[model samples]
Target: MEKTFKFTPEEFRTSVKIIQYLRTAIGSSLENHDEQKVRKYIHQAIVAGHVHRDVFGLNPILTSLQTAQIAVDEIGLHRDGVIATLLYGSVANDDDHEEIDQLFGENVARIVMGLAKIQKLYEKNPVIESENFRNLLLSFAEDMRVILIMIADRVNIMRQIRDVEQEEARHEVSEEASYLYAPLAHKLGLYGLKSELEDLSLKYLEHDAYYMIKEDLNATKKSRDAYIQQFIAPIQEKLTEAGLKFHMKGRTKSIHSIWQKMKKQKCGFKGIYDLFAIRIIIDSPYNLEKQLCWQAYSIVTDMYQPNPKRLRDWLSVPKSNGYESLHITVLGPESKWVEVQIRTERMDDIAEHGLAAHWRYKGIKSGGQMDEWLANIRAALEAGDNMEVMDNFKMTLAPEEMFVFTPKGDLFKFPAGATVLDFAYRIHSKIGNTCVGGRVNGKVVPMRQELHSGDSVEILTQSNQTPKHAWLSIVTTAKARAKIRLALKETQVKDGLYAKELLERRFKNKKIEIEESIMGHLVKKMGFKEVSDFYKQVSDGKLDPNDIIDKYVEIRNYQENHAKEHEARSAEEFEYEGPVEDLSSQSDDVLTIDQNLKGIDYHLASCCHPIYGDKIFGFVTAGGGIKIHRTDCPNAPEMRRRFGYRIVRARWSGKGTSQYSTTLKVIGNDDIGIISNITSIISKEEKILMRSINIDSHDGLFSGNLVVQLEDTTRLQALIKKLKMVKGVKQVQRI
Candidate 1:
């Protein structure tokens, strides 16, 4: 029987009971505030057991009740915010132990579900970035409300983070908050929350650094406080004299942000902008706020020389998060860059509250769209390998970007350094796979060249041209990477698979065992995905057989002994055995690594990883014994299967270097540039050598024969499902 979640009688009662306490506190917290919706949201928490997952043992009654009261006293009730507070971390997945459906009204429960979905802005996927990005876009396209609720929930949670964990855990949470949540809050226009979150998160992400800065700030607090008072006096007096109802104040940059500036700009604290900014919040009709903003700008400019380029007009086109403010960086007293932001009280609320603040005014009905991108994020767990993780990373992280149009007027938004291949994939996968070249802003550029803001891009394609082996070096986006790799793998498998069919077709007449072992050994030597890869390469006029068998046999024995020796080593030794940047078992070979060869002395022969049940052979070659094909490799079959067959059988002699090679062929239905994926697997397997590969397709069919080099067949066969999963690829086999 499957295990299910259940709440103890007391826990269920306490989680929901906090609502009455919160409602009671709100009556005193605000001036004539409405509380029906706020109460409803609080009641939903018990129904949604958020703590049942990752954390436990907190006093739910005391914590929830106290937190709710604090929320009422401090933030008041923007019904949506209140609802989000109750449902924060409420999803049934991850650490969530309860279901909202059990205790809340459907409307409240649904919104809570949506809030839980938008949590991936923090998770990292170093590969498969495009899928993550695609999910983000689709989520936003589906609903903006999900993002709003999530942003609101995080801002509120950070407020109480101190109550949630041990010292180390608190710091970890804060660091995450600083890096991801704080920026998100800033983007959403939650100014008060954004500032506090940034400061608080810093206290956790880097404790020593955070405390050092705090101590320094404290040391100079007396003098700095006096300086702020004097600076704000003139601005206040001028605004008062002008009869404009205004508030002037000083501001300091976030600690982390200041540290980043110091590091990047290579400047001392004294060199950085030290003035507390003056904000003029006036009481005016919404319509009058614009005129007041201009008037303030003029007054400020009159007092100081305003930098022409350091001006922003968000009022005209509000940010996606609903933030709007007029900003100007002026040349102030002592020629300093003093930034001033002017806005009305209402605008201030929207900016500081972000989507949550918007929901307070707009109501859930207005903000009721579903966030599909968040749903896609929820689906991210399906990508089980490094390849998939990397793919997801490239897709989702361009939050502050614009998708402008090119001369022909096509549009796609890219992060600051997107390249031509990124542009091609943005247009369409087909365009990217067949892309031969590109034009950026009407000038021909190498496909790998970086794209700049305002540059229009055009792609070039070839009908017969498939994605090349060199394309991965140039493609910057995960979508492009995944597509190219998939296509290549499909092509390699097909070539070898077809070759396998042909060999079997020929061997049927000879009445000889087209031994799976022999065929595997042969294909492995040539670095084909399957036996078909060898046949197809031979038939296609791209491969030779000699030298493959000898190398295949030599490598097979080396690997067996290595595995045995490795298993005998202690676990501690196993943990620290290799490179630090990547930890895969075959970090050097399994997944392609970032390596600049000091000198190419070693060769991972493309041959059969001669296992115990197989007939093996060895061959001598120039440069090195690099080509390890099967003893019965078709091209080498006549030599081994006939005349020199006896010499091919070599037993386990002395234990040389535990190095070996095997090849694979991934053949399936034709796909555009199927060879890319095949080769990518070799690249990802970094240990595997890709000696040679070929591609061909016609009439809705695609075939790729790839030669993937590996230490042994164990690592080689890892590609079967991966290749089979590629779209349009019909089959995969060992070569």
Candidate 2:
């Protein structure tokens, strides 16, 4: 008693078209599978009566089929990927997981399940906009094909977003595409999709800006085309005359890219001279691609006066995402700047479609540049925390990259603004953990030193030196930050365990039974969120176990006496309130002194230069005024022995706005730019005023003293740290 499935004429025609597309697009991938299976899946989708209708201008079943076609055609995903894409949404929504497993096997079912999880996450608004979107993408880490399908799905939506009627929904979708999906596409090296996503997003999110750029581009289209033709005519002739086979094409900048440039360069459309670029793609054998690219570059540069500063030789060292080309901005006929790009045919294909094209043309099962990139991303995700994951993802998405050299002349690429600590970690985690500083191009620099292109870095490590928690703030790379956090957590756990043992031993000595409830009560009373935090505080000597015992006894006594009234009283009523202090009228005091030192006219001692937050004491001067000195200051012991009567208690209380003069001493290897670097750091600080500077260089070493006026100890310490990071600087300390 089998039933026949009926299909409308239009549905039948659409199904036929999809079948034809799949047969042609995904040719041999379906050779082994029965043709009846595909028909059955399509029939089931049609019979279900669920349609995507509005957004994609097609039924959900057809949209899934089309997405699968795109995955096969564009990304070169395998048969299992295409089948999973085709059936995932419909089956998951219908809760037909077992049916999918029975029909397509467990592999396809697993992929569908993963995709269903992603859909579920998206439906539930987990966090804020960007973070939630990032999490949605990250959830597809298990199956790479799921990411491809999702990307294709978004691309399909973006393509049809113009027909979506809701303006607010369109704007939100556009923002998500621009901020999240586009970056994801770029990271995956799907350049064509990335560009389209960005362009479409700009059209919706910033219509006015988009239209303005479009109008400007249209207005200058005729002249710009003419100029491009005239400019490329000579270079094309030279490339052909050199016995090289090549093709030259002119490309106009996308509106989104133009808008970004306008904002970055702070210039209007008219000021942008190189709006169009000429790409000379050379045809070469597989073995001679680099050589042919360089040959084309030479020919193009020979025809024009290339701007030395504007030359970007990415062919020699390709970008981290596997982009390879030679770009140069040159002076043209009308004295205008013209951008020229030279690459081989292979490189041009990669430049257009990115990693997808690589996979398609190479005909390999992974194991290439893209694999390396994906491995790095996976490592970052596995090692990093939530925020670190986002940071690492953003770093991978960044367009700019800097190539720095090791001391042995090996080149390593890192994101711009990466510090020496990042470099050390990139080399090895051990090197980074033990690294105190580095020598950038033979000049000693702090671990926080930002590396630049062409700089040869030599790491300075010590056996005893370990990573500080401050290194987390110093590094820009996720690997270093994750390692530092992990190391710190391990240390904290060890200390916490030790503290727990110590507390348990003390409790035993006092014959007090320690229970989980008691420990929880103690932690809450001490204002700690967790027992481990309390233990850490105890291990750090900031908390006393005796205090906990006394509090426990006090609580027991109070509970025994007030058990009848405890339920009636509010939690606030039972809160511990110590004896109130007397609030008597006092004399008017304007000095920004510590709370303990009242009515004192105290200036910081010139010998010690104690600042805010320092453990300090007030010493009565011969002039009958007080001078503040740090408790650990070198002059403290002598002063305490000589003038014990003059000493008074002092501590930081209220904020201070008055500036104080301080002197700092810096030591480093000798370099002519040391003085300039020191002065630049000082000048950059708005709150710092330089009173004087003295620098002396001799025997490859330099010593400098800077007398500066600063507002407080915090700013002064920050300034000293900045000086330490400067090139050639070894140490910085207050005088």
Candidate 3:
């Protein structure tokens, strides 16, 4: 029996301040049916030591709880989310789903379960592809609150990473956070989280560089702060005089971002100026938000000499991630560069919290732009196989974006370096599959032509045109690659089916029955893993049907002659003493040598040499007593159709001791000593006895036929391998 501890009503009432703060932070949409119970859960979590002690030696439960609170609270999620955040780690560890369900309800339990699955996924496959990561996230798309929780958890981990002891673990965690989690945050419109994650990752990954930037910023903080105050003073006075309600604040650049600028500009810390940005948050009416942002932008530029080329008018057209801010870099006091941002309070919140803030402040439905973006991501993931999905994921995660247009004025966004084929596939898979080439801005361009922003693309398609293998290398988008591979595979399957039909017709004409065993041998002889591959080659005209038929005929003749000679010699020593057993029944059962027919010798036919494992039938020839032929022999159909009365059932009694003769064709470059090399290899194999060799040379290529004797198909295959390794040899195949 386990003791269950619970929080009392008095204990919950004492935490009213915390609950009220959460309620206000989360907005009016939040609801708590029993605030007492929610508070009690938090209290229990703290008492269980889940809040105070560090979970992963980086962040304590309290820190994660706060981060989760900020995440849900900013998004205006319901009260269950708040309770789950506090007890997520505790419930996860104790497997206390029943308690959570009974107290906080099933929704809270489900969210915690999703979080546990996410943690497990990350732990088991740390190096998972972006597509797989997206797929995992989308699995919980029905309840997107889980993803929000994960993002919050990641943010808290990065914030408290400094407390982590092992340098190696910190480096790994930071790299994953930077490369994987940061891009995800950015994609989700969590710009603040993205920037923070990037900065924290850079802090540990590039410690020396981080500290240098930090030390430089601190050393110049006094002068920087004074300069910012001087620059904002006039703008602040004018905005107030204009009756606009606003608050101006100075923000220093994050160390991670500062380092990025230094690297991108190829300069030292002193050479890099504008280490801070001044943000003006205006409190405007709902309808006047955009107008107030522009007004502030004008007031700020009027106070300083603004750089026209450095201005970003994102307020006019919000970024894809819903970021709305007007940025301008100006020459400030002391001739130093300074960046200023102008946005309304709503815009400011959206900028800080990204998608969550966008939804909460804008009052947009869940199925709007955010859903559309997620659908696109899901489409990309579903479009390709695992490897291709990963490639697409990386492409999607790329920060640099370009906007291209179709002939109909439809706008499309793609990563940098995406080509015309990628554009076609992005439009539709069918369009990409049939695309021959395209015109870019009224000029004919190859499908591989890299598109630029604002270019009008017109895809030129043909009905007969299908995706080519080379198109895979040309297209950069995951969707294009996946569609191309699928089309190619379909084509291969179609060709294989046609080849199979063609082979069947050829065998029928040659009076032979096609069998799986016969096709297996042919596939092995042609160096194919499966019969379908051989069929594809045949359908593509790479192999000759006549050559295959002739080889089968040759094998049948050899077996027939050998069987005739044995039957004649055995007849001299033995005489039948009883009625003959039913050959059909004897063939179906385990075959054994008949003592009564000891004198009447019979052997495997030369024409269709029946191996120990082969399905066979015996034919009594005019001179030979009986000849064994494989059921799928080239002559079996003719024998069965015409001389049906003469055919007798046959089966192999035991393994033969004698070697079997097989013919091999070797093709190679007509190099000097190439024939000698082939002969040398065959001679080296002690078990392989060479019967004859014939070589034909034409132009720069040579083809040779070598007849060799081996004990079994295994030895023959081994000999073929040895022959294939000879210098200048292109192919070695049993005919």
Candidate 4:
């Protein structure tokens, strides 16, 4: 029996440290006490694999674990965020080890199952680019909380890969950072993770480029610090006035980002800007986020001229990841460019942890909040097909604010640009399919119309309306497109199978076996060179079997009347002797078969049998090899139609000078003196061509097979054709 692919439990001990670090780093709401359980469970997950304690538990992971612990000690994971963090990425690989699943439970197990679905999808059908797209979109649907935790997990993993010996490790870890991880981090609005991912990715992809940028950045360290201090000075004064508690810090751009810009823009150190940023972390509520932004803008612009275009008012419209911030770039002392980001405490938490911060939303029920997030994300995901994903995501997943009315003066929030169709689908797929259009402020409109922040949308659906192809054109979510395509493909297969069967039956009746087996042989024989080519011919009716055989033999072409000439009595059959030259004469056109040959049915007509150097035509006999005949033989006409394709225009050469047999047909009226006249013509002419002559008469009509000798078919036809126009001849042909 084959052994199961397994690794040791000690291998995952490091994962214990890594998961704990994540659990702690995420900080606070749901269940800090669960960390030990989560760690123990993951460690025991080694079914048939060895754990690399040092490999999985790296510095950043440990640091992240500490950060999560701080968050847990301070704010708490609320319920949803905790569940997501523990569950995501758990089911992707084989999980025969029982402890992890036993501890994580069904809720976490469900999320893992979702992740497993995506992994199995790609495993079954590998498409590198599509798989990435599919994984990203599907993760969005399973749970937003899960998405954030996985992003964090990836960030830590990148840091861990630094310890792997460089010789054999797959380069994709770093490559993934630059191409996929960083984009995901930025998309989630987790600037911290995004930056780390980029810096780490660049550190490996281009070591020299990263170091040079770092060195240059270090050179400006003091100035950058001083610049940040100056920008924060007025904020300090205001914070003191308002009695607000806050902390401030200065940070540098990630080496990856800096390196990317340097190479992409073809710039040196001087071209890069905003390498320094000021972060003002203020303790406040979500509503107070804008106040800090306004205050920070006032203080910064007062001291320095702000670039109007540099302003990003995300607080007015938080990102899809629940990120709220105010970003601006201004010209500081010495005209040096500087960037500043201001956000309240809750907003900061969400930025760092994304949906992970839902754990800290005061008074929010963890299960309800998580369920709501799952529902909304599922709404976004269940909207589009694979082809239109990026566009659909931009339209759905980008930060947009929706204003939905409640029954009693309340309003609900939705991602911006949500369509009536999205709303209907969000409500339920059945309603979405029935929804024909909707009203905004009591006016009818297309269902796909974008719902604005304050628009009171009332969806209208008709009872009889069915899904249309037009719906696919308007709907902008993966969820909608996938459902539509699945239905469409099912219907198409049903319809297509009918037509396929008809074609198959028609081919069957024609005795044409066009299946792979028969076509394979013909494909090889015809020298067409490709399987596709052969099938295409069979499908299109371009290939013919008889033609294939003729081509296979490389036979010469023949005249039309070749098959019928053998039935005529105008030629005689005889056996051949030594070299045909012994009996053959220039005027006697016929074929002589080798005497060593016996029981061959076809005979070269003595009147038209062609020997060496004679133009030929073939008379296909009822029994065998086509009898050689001259082109103009009288009886060659009917045979040409019956077997013209089978006829071969043959001519003998000195190489095959071995004896041959032939027959000649002589026809004349049965007058008393006709035979004597025919006999005398050849006998007196000193030609032994008239090997035999006979007379038969009924009502004075005449026909006879007169034996003669000459070359192959062509010369025979010429001689026989001339004999038909002879003064006393009724007709002449090869027998």
Candidate 5:
């Protein structure tokens, strides 16, 4: 007999009570059908007791329900977010994405999937400090609500894990809460949750310090209350006499913050002053909130002299994370300075709930600052360096914006320390490409000069200026760096092409045919990674063509001698003369084109000479047989446009079965021994055979057509690249 665990009658009742609570809480927010669906899932999760139990043996269903409640009441999420939180465990454990989408909608499915991915990420127990690890974590969270729900869920878990026996796991969770999630919450403007997370983490990780502070706060509770009441009595009377409707409270700083202050100031908890701040929340209409806040600021400053340096006026300009308030430090009744924060009801809500309240007040679907931040995330991911993405993400999380202006006085906001080049790219990529420098406040400055707040900037552009690889190091913004990298890559490709053409022209002039294998060995021995990199160096005039040719010849001779020695040994070991079958042309399988149709009568098109592994498509010829042409064939666009109905999608089914015939046109200076040099290279190549050569010589120029046979495009491209490296070859092209 096997033992089993089932929910007790009391546990089942507890779950039902939670469900009723959720029903009342979510009553008007969700449609009747949606509410029923959510309850149905909750009921199922409760009955499936095993699904709720973790290694700690806690009540799983209750945990999820409590998490959902936090998401609703604390995080201000509505139906879809609530539903995803309720079903996260079930969806993560089961592979029923279609069922989730069909029942709830695609949004719910996506959020659940993101949650599942993050759960998997946590299960790996990755090193928390790794940047790539953090990047992957953010990338997995495709939707912002996923992050919010996870934060809420983490808070619920933190609340419940205080008594768990697994001390090590508890400590790890607490450390993670401090390291990743708390900062995330703070970045999102959820100061309340941020403080809660930090306090709980400290309680678990620094038990002695946490309790010490807690006991001290408890001991000082009576005096603190008296002091707060005495301090606010006069201010409340003044505001009331001024005909303002408002409420005031003394907000204590978190235990973690107090501990931090003690460590920084090298003092005891009692020695730290300003442990609590008086927050005055005003009940004012939207238009008058700022005015009333200023009035309150003036009244308080008049009543008690305020420290001008300690005044913070965020009401004039809200933070990038949507935090707005007015803070002042004033001399109080006992000559002790106290911090006071004043804000309207709306501002207070945003300050308390972070982006959730901001989203609600602004209409959830509207494109606001948060949406722009999301777009920046997408762009950073596209830049393709995971570490860079993580850096940009961390910067954006708690971004401090500094305002700058264009020559025309158009205002722009950039992260602190942003450069003039960053501004140029933000204006337009074309401007960035041509930016020579900038004029900051009527003074010409280098492009890398950091812009100060309120500095007027005018970009200087020159047509001949282009993006250099060095620009990558100069720009601070991710957008500028990504665009500069793209421009440099494009320029490198064009330069490589030009160098290859010049090398081939030189090879044709020398009349030396090159061997790709020998040249590849030579390039590697010279410390190059790829042949194109070698070409780039050649375009930069870093290597002479004559020296490269000499090296190629030396390597070729050495390889030939090594091969002869092996052949001689093999011939002496086993001497059996027999006719060998030529199986090279044997076909492996017919091409499996698109549309699942096979065995079609088709041949490789001569116009493009497409080989195995080439991107291809089928064209019905006038003879009714299909012709396979490379997608990049010069004639493809014209054919597709002229005979749209005759074109069909196609691709190579497998590796090439046999060799292909191709033609190369060579042009060079009419120089002595050039033809011999070219013919010598072709005859020495083991895999390539020259079928024919037709030459025409005119004044100062030699042009020739050479036909060769090789297995596939890979070999054909190698052959062309080799021919391009000859000393006098000016041009090489496949015909």
Candidate 6:
């Protein structure tokens, strides 16, 4: 069905050459005999086996070799990652994995397995809108090397797809490169590779835009180079006179980044200044790196008028991603602003290569800033909530960030516009939940006060303060929101259980027998859809048990006298009807579940709100047929642990047609006509209907929840993005 590439004589010679080069490059770890064995194994596999070429018609063998070369040379992944890249295509099944294990080693086999699993995931042709795909890929790849190799492979593929005849295939590849791999590279600190991937993606996706910028840069190359040289000449002389051992390069901004800046600044190419930054990389001893960089900074500032407000000193405290540098903006030769960056050689290497160089210079598994970030990722994954993991992971990957400080001068970084509550949560969950206000720079500020760079903050807490429902709209950090959600849930559960016990005790004292069927009917007659909702109301003191007994008695008597008209579902009627072991992808008989299920009585759970195209499973209800829940539902862990047998496999069968009700929480400045603007956008959207909106305003800011009906998560995400772009709209989230 698909075209396959079989090994030829030329491939055998190439394999031998690759082995020889790797042996020398890898040094004593790969001896002559080991190299020969590797070459022999590759040659035999190629001669006897075949690999299906991609849509671009590139030979898998050549692709693998190129990826291995990039992994080893560019990414500094010289061990199992390189080997795994070369042999990844050979792994198709368990037997192949066993063979690899026996031939190479367990580590290589494991990497191969991980690579194959990710390949299978991609083969399923998942839509990009499903953000869970990234989390799934991460879950499959346990070792960081697997991810590094995959990134290398993606880079190699992007380099080759330039000439592919298949336009659609090439476009898809480019999108994946930009949307997935580029962000990964950026997060891992591979600035060079990240920029390359972004530029390539832009070239393919927006051919005209890419060439327009490229042509502009080409037309001005002479002048730009001349200006850079003129600017560097003076700095070079000053540094040389200071006896500093260093080299400098004028690094031009990537085309993709320039395009982004153009869009963000709402200006054309001619209007964009500071198109490049000058980097001064120093050679110094480990202990003297800070000294040298500061010296260089001083020398440069002395030569030019430095803008104090634009100064960024990262040497004292590096970025969480392990980037250390001193940044300053100064007036250069034409009275134009020029950005200058100063760092030592080691710091420069890490800044260019990211995690790979970090691990290489510092031994593997060392405790560093980058390692700390990785460890946080591991902890999030271990928590097993894909949505939460994605939220936290995306925050770490955010580009625009601001660093704030504690009263004790401890530095912390947060996404731009992070508020005082976000700072509190960043310190600890308990402090966040109890945070009443904050003292920012010796002035008392509200929790909603936005923080700025270098702001010294001290959180004010009250012992009796608990998280309010409205607090969800105040915090911006994912960790804070997740913790607040948890606290709210714990409070709900405790109240619901207490209310249920109180109601049961009242029924017993009233000498009234509580019948499941009659109670279910009575609850529905009272207009409550979920029994949990009824208990929540009772716990809030809005409903009294004495009044409930009176109503239940009235309904029970009426039901006893009249014949039943409809089937009633009990509170404990929920049941599970699927296998207990791994139900992630297996389905005995698929139920096309969305907002509604055909031929089956199913209700979407309110706890996590499973929308169309969401990863979902069915929980059989006692009298009710089923209830669909998102796989990442907040209550899923406890439900699965306590009611293992009630879980059933389910999936969506087709594109969703029916609209589902969802709520969004939005917070922003309380500007005039802001509400009207939001409503206008919603009304303009086709097939998107807003049912209701509630707004609360205090202290020049407003927070509101808008309930809307939409077809699926993709549309929901687009709507959220649009709302975020709305004037004065600061934050938006699906509740």
- Global lDDT of each candidate: 0.53, 0.71, 0.68, 0.55, 0.77, 0.76
- Model 4 regions lying over 4 Å from their true place: 1-104, 118-149, 167-170, 234-247, 283-289, 362-735
Candidate 6: Cα lDDT at 478: 91
Task: For residues 1-735, write the lDDT of model 5, one tens digit per residue.
Answer: 113436678777877887788778767656558867765765665455425467666666677778888877776666667788878875535465787888887767777887886675554345554433343444446565688888888898899898999999889889888888897788678888899999999999999999999999999999999999999999999999999999999998899999999999999997899899999999998878889999999889989999999999888777767788999999998899999999999989989987657644532222456545744443433332233443444323333556566665455667788999999999999999999999987899999999865566899999988898888888888989999989988878987898878777777788877766566788899998887789888988998988887777788788666544433221112222222444335556467767699898888888877767678899999999999888999999999889999999886665665656678998865653455557778878866777767777666567888877666778878877877877557798987
Prediction-by-prediction clash tally:
91, 1, 20, 77, 25, 5
lDDT of 1 by residue, 37-156 (tens): 334443454355434433423443334344444444333433333444455543445333234444433334544555554343223221212333333433332233344444444454
Estimate the TM-score of every prediction. Answer: 0.44, 0.51, 0.48, 0.43, 0.52, 0.52
Quote the positional error of residue 41 for candidate 5 in Å: 5.0
lDDT comparing candidate 4 with the true structure:
0.55
Full candidate order by lDDT, most accurate first: 5, 6, 2, 3, 4, 1
Q: How close is candidate 3 to the true structure, as a TM-score?
A: 0.48
Residue 599 C-alpha lDDT in model 6: 51
Local accuracy of candidate 2 as per-residue lDDT tens digits, 1-735: 113334468876876787787778656655366366755775676566542354334456656766776666656665566788877645626367787777776656766877886665444333324442453354334555567778887777777668667788788778878877788778677788888889999999988999999999999999998988888888877877889988889999888999999998999998777788889888887778778887877777777788999999887777766677899988888898888898888778878866566643442123454556554444433432233432333323223566566665455667779999999999998898899999986799999999864466889999987667788899998888998888788878888899989988988999987755456766798788877788878887988889877887676566445543433332222112222332112213234454543556667787877665567888888999888898988899998999998887777655645556678887876654556557777888986777766666666676777777766788987888788776457899888
Compute the lDDT for candidate 6: 0.76
Error of 4 at 305 (Å): 2.0
**Residue 654 local lDDT, model 5:** 58
**Model 3 segments beyond 4 Å from truth?**
1-64, 72-76, 92-103, 128-135, 138-141, 333-335, 359-368, 371-735
Q: Across residues 1-735, which tens digit of lDDT does each residue of candidate 6 receive?
A: 344346568766876687567667665444246545555666666555545666787777777887888777776655555677878765556677877777766667777887876675564455443334444444446555677788888898999888789999899989998988887787677888899999999999999989999999999999999999999998999999999999999998999999999999999998889899999999988878888888999899989999999999888877767778899999998899999999989899889877656644532232564567655544443432233443454223324566565775455777778999999999998999889999987899999999865467899999988888898898788988999999888878888899988988999998888876667877898899998888889998998788889998998777544422212322122222322333222223335645455556577888877778788988877885898899999888988998878987778765666677788999876653566668889989997878777777767677888878777899999999989877567899988
